[model samples]
Target: MAAPHDVPSAAQLVAAVRDFLADDVLPAVEGRVRFHTRVAINVLGMVEREIELGPAQAAEHERRLAGLGVADDAELAAAVREGRFDDSALVEALRDAVGAKLEVANPGYLGDG
Candidate 1:
C-alpha cells in the first residue's frame, strides 16, 4: 500500500531508463576497460558543453559591452578562463554561449522538456 505521491510517474521511469543507458550500457560495452572509461565519457560530455557555450557567451558579453566599449577578445578570453568577468556580463555571456552551442544539440542529452 503506497500513497499517490509515492508512486513512480512515467517521467521518472523514463529518466531511470535513460540513466541506465548512460551509467550502465555505455560502460559495459568497453569490455575489460575500467570504470574510468565511463568517468572519462562523462567528463568529455561536460567539456563539449563548455566549448559549445563558452565562446558565444563571451561574444555576447562583448556585444553588450559595445556600449562601454571596453570589450576585447583577448581580455575576454583571459577573463573567462580566470573567471573574472563582471557579474552581469558573465551571465549574459553564458546564456548566449549555451544557447548557441545548444542549437546543435547532443544525442546523449536525452530530454524533451
Candidate 2:
C-alpha cells in the first residue's frame, strides 16, 4: 500500500538513521558507547522491519489465533500449558507464529548459515 504521506516515510527515515549510525557513528565510538550504538542499530533495524511487516503479521496472527479457538497469545499459552491441545497442526501453527516474530526481530537468526 502506498504511504498516505510524502517521501521519506517512517521506514525510510529509520533506515537512514540506522545506516548513518552503522557506517559513520559506530566506527568512531568505543567501549560502552560502541556496544550501546550496536544495540541501537539493532533496535532501529527491528523498528524498520516492524514498520514494513507489522500489519500483515498482526492480521495473520489474529487469523491463527482464531484457528486455534483462542482470542490471543496469552490464552493460547494457557491452553498449551493445560494440555488442552496437542497435535502436529498446533505445533506448526505455533512455529509459524514464532517464525514471523523472528523475521521482525532478527531474520539472520533464522538463516540456515
Q: Which candidate comes out best when scored by lDDT?
A: 2
Cα distance off (Å), candidate 2, residue 88? 0.8
| True lDDT of residue 92, candidate 2 | 80
**Superposed model 2: Cα runs more than 4 Å off:** 1-4
lDDT of 2: 0.93
TM-score, cand. 1:
0.31
lDDT of 1 at 35: 58
Backbone Cα, N, C clashes tallied per candidate:
3, 0
* lDDT of model number 1: 0.57
For candidate 2, the per-residue lDDT at 68 reads 88
lDDT of 1 by residue, 13-61 (tens): 4445556657787766765454555665555555555545556666665
Tens-digit lDDT track for model 2 on 1-113?
37688888889999999999999999999999999999999999999999999999999999998998999989998999888886886898888999999999999989893
Clashing pairs in 2: none
Cα RMSD of all models vs. native, in order, equals 12.7, 1.7
